[model samples]
Target: MKQRIITAVVALLFFIPLVAIGGMPLQLLAAAMAGVGVYELFNMKGLEIKSLEGVLAILASVLLVLPKATWFNFLPDTVTNITLFYLIVMFILMVPVFSKNSYTFDDAAFPVLVSLYVGFGFQNFILARESGVTVLMFALLVVWSTDIGAYFCGMKFGKNKLAPHISPNKTIEGALGGVICAVVVALVYLLVWPMANYNLLIMLPLTAIFSVVGQMGDLVQSAYKRHYGVKDSGNILPGHGGILDRFDSLLFVFPLMHLVGIF
Candidate 1:
């Protein structure tokens, strides 16, 4: 518990500043995080990060993590980020053919899937930040509140399991508590940092929905970790596991926020 708290403080100290000063630094940070997330996902499948597929996955993720504005100056208008991403995917698929089936198509699929998952997720994060710091922080608050609320709520009032197979510790009661907590925090957040677009009524239900989506994202990560037979994604953060472990909820929330016109 002590280690967890210490790591959280240390991480936030380093992370918050970059987030506040959103620009190339934040973009770089996002790209690096996306790369690490790709590494962790690849690690789960016993794939080598130094391998060709791993390198390509990391590259794809970093490309996706950066905002389209960054690409505008260098990349020709003719070729989009999607085009480049597809090219990388084709290269990954071709690896098996050149290697005479040693690195099977099955092996190639994992990197591509992980790249898209981690990549687009982080890309949305950049998009959120680009929209406004308040927008990004709002998403963060929802994810963090949900996680904290679920932990304590489950310990105190949990009776029914939410998903016994994926995450045995979670409970339906806890999930509800998390949504409640998220809505409350989001309300307070709006009170302090009022956005022109969002009002109390609009935010109330949206917060609950985001909380649920965030929990589902966490469950998805838990499902994969269970399949990989690992306790945590990685030991990058002593108590927090890995970048993917910590950012799972945020990844889901940011994209959903954009989809729902929060951005």
Candidate 2:
């Protein structure tokens, strides 16, 4: 618990600044996160990171997440997107044909999937950040509130397991508590940051939906870890495990917000 608190505080201190700065800083942050997250995911599959495939996978993942970044300002958006997509596709397709021993179809597929997962996830995150810092911050706060609320609520009042196979720790009562807590946080944010211009009626349902999605994201990651027979994604964040462990909910929440036209 102590380690978890310290890790969260340190993460907030570092992340808040990048989020506040926005633009390239946030893009770079997302890129770095995608890189590390892809590495950790590949590691789970027992893949070697020093290999050519690993390097390209990480780079492709980072590039996919850097759509809003200024690094490619010289190129047109369409061109940049196409070039990156071509590069990633070529690498994935060619590797299996050229390097049959070291890289197989399974190996090739992992990078592509990882790229799409982390890339698309962080791309939506960057989109949210580009929309406005306030919108991004609200999305983040609601996810955190749901997590906190569920943890305490589960510990205190949980009686039935929500999903015994996927996530034994979660409870139906805890899920309800998380939704309630997220709604309260959204309401508070609306009051304080009225400039967000959230319709109270719309915001309430949005908050509840996001909270549920966030929890689903958590459960999905948990299932992944369980399938691989691993405890945490990585030891990068000490108590938090890895970038994936910390940002799973954030990844899912932002995309959902985009779909709902909130971002």
Candidate 3:
């Protein structure tokens, strides 16, 4: 816990300035995030997509994010474009070979999932930058509130399990508190940041909805770790485990916020 706090401080140390500056710095940040996400993803599935296939997937993910960096007028809306990309990738996965006994179909799912997940999630960071740094700040706040609220509320009042199969520790009381914290954070930020032209009602409930989804995101990662019988995604970010470990919730939030046009 202490290590996570220190790591977050270090992250803010670098993250705040890059995001504030926008342009290449933010774009570089997005690229690095995309790289880490792709690495973790391909590793997670245990599907060995290597050589040309791996490079192609990584290249596609970067290209998927580049449009978000530039203020390109022709770039499609972030949410629909990303979600659609996921569908396109899924379709790519369905392509069959001359024989079902062949290894081709077995390998198809990895690159597709990596391309879509890393591509979509990382690109949305650019959308976050569109609304200024405060938008990113609020996204962080919503996720943080959910984490903290769930911890305290679960300790104090939890009885029912949220999903015993996926995340045994998560509880219904914790989920409720997490949502409430998300809504309160949205409301408070709206009151404080008069310059941010966000729709408070939309932002508030969306925070709650995304917070729940974020919890699911965390559970998804936890499931991955459990599946692999490993601890942490990687040690890339000390004290925080890995890039995915820290920003697992952000994956869900960035795309969801884009869907609601919050950024």
TM-score for all models, in order of appearance: 0.96, 0.93, 0.82
Clashing pairs in 1: none
Q: lDDT of each structure?
A: 0.90, 0.85, 0.75
Model 3 over residues 1-263: C-alpha lDDT tens digits?
88878987988899888877987778877877887777776676664446455655766677677653253446566644445455555545545443353647657766876677777787887778767788878888889899989989998999999888767888999989988977887788878874344566656767788899888889888888888776787788887788788778888888988887777
Question: What is the C-alpha lDDT profile of model 2 across 8-44, one tens digit per residue?
Answer: 8998999999999998888888999999988988898
Question: How does model 3 fare in lDDT?
Answer: 0.75
Model 2, position 95: C-alpha lDDT score: 85
Q: Using alpha carbons, what is the TM-score of model 2?
A: 0.93
Off by over 4 Å in 1: none
The true-versus-predicted C-alpha distance at residue 196 of model 2, in Å, is 5.8
Q: Quote the lDDT for 235 in model 1.
A: 87
Ranking by TM-score: 1, 2, 3
Cα lDDT tens digits for candidate 1, 31-145: 8999999999988878799999999999988878876667555767787667778889999999999999999988898999999999999889988888899989999999999
**How far does residue 31 in candidate 1 sit from its true spot (Å)?**
0.7
Lowest summed-lDDT stretch of 10 residues in model 2? Answer: 77-86
- On lDDT, the candidate that comes out on top is 1
Deviation in Å, model 3, residue 167 alpha carbon: 1.4
